[model samples]
Target: MKKQFFYIVLMGLVAPLASCNDFLDMEPMSEITPEDYYQTVDQVEEFTNQLYADILTTHGSYSSTFEIDKDTDNQPSTETPGNKYDNTGQWKVSMDNSSWSWTNIRNVNYGIEVITENYENGTITGDETSLKQYLGELHFLRAYAYFSMLQKWGDLPILTQAFNDDEATLVEASKRSPRNEVARFILKDLDLAAKYMTPDFETSHTRISQDCAYLMKSRVALFEGSWLTNFKDTPFVPNGNGWPGTAKDYNKDYQFPAGGIDQEAQFFFQEAVKSAELVAEKYKNSLTRNTGITPQSVSDVNDYFYMFGDDDMSTYPDVLLWREYNKGLGITNHLEVIVQGGYDVTRSMVDCFLMEDGRPVYNSSIPYDDQTIAKARSNRDPRLVAFMKQPGQINYFINEDYPADHARKDEAFPPLDVGDGTVNRSLTGYRIRKGGSFDKARCDQWNSYTGSIVFRATEALLNYIEAEYMLTRNIQAGHILEYWKLIREAAGFTGAAADPQTTNTYTSIDKEKADWGAYTAGKLLTDVTLYNIRRERRCELMAEGLRWMDLIRWRALDQMCKTPYHVEGFRLWDVMQNEYDLEPADYDGGNDAFVTPPSRGQYIIAYENIQEKSNLYRDGLHWMMAHYLEPLPIKQFLLTSSDHADVELSPLYQNPYWPLVADSPAEQ
Candidate 1:
């Protein structure tokens, strides 16, 4: 996978998509140099346009962003288990950096170079406004590329310009920057991007704007601040115990830019608050209303329910960045699941949503029951429950677009035929209702036209709340109270109920043991205010592909090393079994005896139910200190070396607790 990622980056081939010109026609890089080809702004814009189409992760299948929460407590899937949580430590060192590929980086660097050089040299003949906007896009794209890898690999090579393949130049440039420096570099790029961008671009919302840049900037700041604060004295951080970066000559005598780690972390917290406030303040009134409408209710369709499936999100003010799919251009998305159970979310996600009255379900007086799926969602947060399928619910909430032949995956007691493909589905009883529509065009394979959101403005709100609390250790400080209130109210709370303090008062840290977010660095978080802040984020961004990042940044699952966690779902052995007409028995090729017995637990265990005792996580999910950061690819080390695969000579360093040998797993 690493080699594949490297190849894509090395080749820098942009697959033609639906565009104004022929996307298939290759850019004649050999014939067109900056002196000749980049004379017009449109020419430069065309090159940058490919970044938008190629970089963003548009919908590819039923399990695109929805499946990102798989290993996290928020969501689990039947489509095999994740190596991170299976306790076998199968996350071995790769031959190449698939996840760490710099394909987009190289492209962005090239665009920035030619455009800036041409504009400064008077070679480009266009308005400064358009040229600056396109340059802003390149900068934003570069920052985005770096931020994505920063989460996976804490330390990264900060590549500002495209480099030649000369051995000395390449090896010298491979020196890994400290994680904090990489984060700072990303923020600087975003700063330039925002300075060059407009608040409202003439182009549609599909393009990145100043608001989007600020939101992403806030996200990166909050992430780094949280990580540095949580892993203060750990090997994963620079200058900390057993830090691998300190082993290399360039990083061995590193000095914190802010004097110390604590000061540096505070700097990020301030940056997070500063950038987030810019976006949140502007878009606070723009949060889409939650109409509290379910499929079972007799209300006109809720706009919030259709936000993810809508073909156009340009009008939605709070949606910072989104991708529009056009069927006419042969650029379509395929997320149709013929069966309702393709992407199953975990029950913990349901529990994460607070009761509309601002209280956790464990302590709420709202007469809630956990035995059935319906009872669990009753009177809870509307936005969270809206995407969770309930019994007797229609497969398509609004089916004006689907045709007669369009197959429906309507809920019929959470279909649990766990052997074949679609016939055996819905691993957990909880089904994901995100990106679902009755549109026949969308239901067709590779023919959907729904817009895919790359960045939502709500992230700014989430980042501000967490950053403020982390910095001051008080939600009352700064605009944390105001920002948090907006989020709570948007989720359907009102008056005193909308106040975050109310939830903080009623919250019990012990009761939140099931939630991985409740812990940081292997111990329960003592402050209730911060826990509630985290709870809001977990609820708001359930399956939007940010859960894993949150979990590791907080060091949430560090306790798993001693006390492993079982991946559980709906209560199949309880009265729900009778409601769903399921029999609790041992597995026999997934016939009638597919479910795990009552001895395992009343709720469904995703891994424990497997046959022949072949379950990888039968011992439950566990973690190690080394698991926080991925080991560097062996090929990266080899390329950085003066001669042969001499890892010692290489300026790049492997992550702490990870092995230097190829294909080897973590030492911990």
Candidate 2:
């Protein structure tokens, strides 16, 4: 059935491709000499434009990895009916090996190699310093691709040049490099690129800037260092790369490959701290801060979160890197998949946050039932209110209930305007409002239509806070508090500017202090602050494609999956379909087509407590392996070196050294 669907979709796309070619064939294109191609600044400008397009094509909205990895934005309903596969319920498989492969690497290398060769051969000459700058941009882009590769597949073949089909076929079976080696290579490229790139956003969204290179380096170094040092128990080794049959190389490797878990942790943490500090200091002007007049109302709502909203861009005080959503080049549409029922906010994450006094609400000290939970939720972080709308709150569009489908939309629609129902509201009793638009004239029914793709300075600050808190508890406490203060101030919390819609719980104070020292290495900030940081991350980055990676790195999928599942609630008065005198045509919205109900009068919104055997929390871990990693193409594995049979495994299929299982092989 899935195969049939794939073929049908693929076939449907052919007509558009044919139409595109027809138009392109008639358009007269410019002919250029090698000298003219990179000669003047104008040609260089065009090259940068093409580079941006490349980045967008590979890493932008269309990136499957990004979509699959982040559990926040779900797969389109058209793609996954009933939203069953979307919750990432399936196990990892080796399908689409070509899609997961490092095919893009060669193209990036080719572009860089060509640009660099031209500059070196004196085919294109300008200010020698600026020429190096152009070269730096290319290097940064190439480095970016490799960094992405290392993250996806810990150790992979580091192909430096573009390979022809013949060359690819002729080359001896290559072994994967160690992750550490890949990290070192990436850093070297980034550092070299930094020298030539300028720290500006003027050229194009795709061009490499110094700040962007630094930003990328900091993020890469932090994740690599943190994950390697911390993930010791798993198949992952801390200091060295995972390539088969090679002594760890520290210099050529990312770090000095000598330390054990603790030693590596300290080293990586130190690097993360240093890199984060550099980006923070250098890009102070790029921070996202609220410029609104109501200081108090907006102080706790980070400008960074709002930066994605159309009206909030000019207010971002610190925006270092951003992708352009251009209508001019016919790339205006931002393809994002948003679930109407708060599908991204897993039940587990909802339970993880503490009450206003920084005490876990789930603890025995508090009541575990609905009433207490509702009251406790009020006293929590200000960002929570910014992100979710509770049962009774009014926003742009009042989400009456968490209905399962459009069938409930018709049932919930009241003859006299009032409310949907009492029991069927959001389970957390909340709906998302962050990415929502405030344009009274336009209502946001389809997601991709909202705001821009923004990268803010708050993320840099948050990264620093996480690194620092992990390293030292006492000394970094003050710094962590300072960063939080900045975040709060910028988010619009305080006296007069306080939003009327903001959670009253922001003002609710907790008098008692609960113990978290035992759970978090005795770090003061590690307890409440850690959860707050995560909450902030969720609130700010929700539906922006960061949740899944956060879950993986934190290894919290097991906990997150346990979160409650609730559809928008709809009140049911009867079971008969004919009572309303409605026909099938009256029920069709065309927007929500996959969803249906058990009967006509029954509201599909409320989560009927059906005793299903499957549990989200227990099953969540399976998604990590299945959706996060794509298996190595079986055909490619067959082409591997005979001596290194184990190397054929894809990270998704199993760890590199695991014995191959026939049922789990890519062929199956």
Number of the top candidate by TM-score? 1
lDDT by residue (551-650, candidate 2, tens digit) is: 4455342222333323322232233233234444323322322212334234322222222334232111212223333444443443342432553432
Quote the positional error of residue 256 for candidate 1 in Å: 0.6
Compared with the true structure, model 1 gives a TM-score of: 0.92
Global lDDT of each model? 0.75, 0.43
Collision pairs in model 1: 2-96, 2-98, 402-440, 417-424
- TM-scores of the candidates in the order shown: 0.92, 0.65
Best prediction by lDDT: 1
Predicted candidate 1 versus true structure: per-residue lDDT over 1-668, tens digit per residue = 11111121233222223343521222323235445687888887888887876566552332255566677788765555667664566888887767767767766776787678878888888788988998998899889888878888898877776554345655666778999999999999999999998768764677889988899889899989889989998888899988888877799999999999999999999999999999988988889866666544325577776677678887777887877778899877665543234467776777778887878888776866878888777888877677777777766544535563434646667766654444536667777667665454466656666777778888898898889888888767888898888887777778777898889888999988889999998899899998888899988887788998889888898898889887678887778877655444444323244556677778886665655546566556788778887777787666566665587787778888888898888877
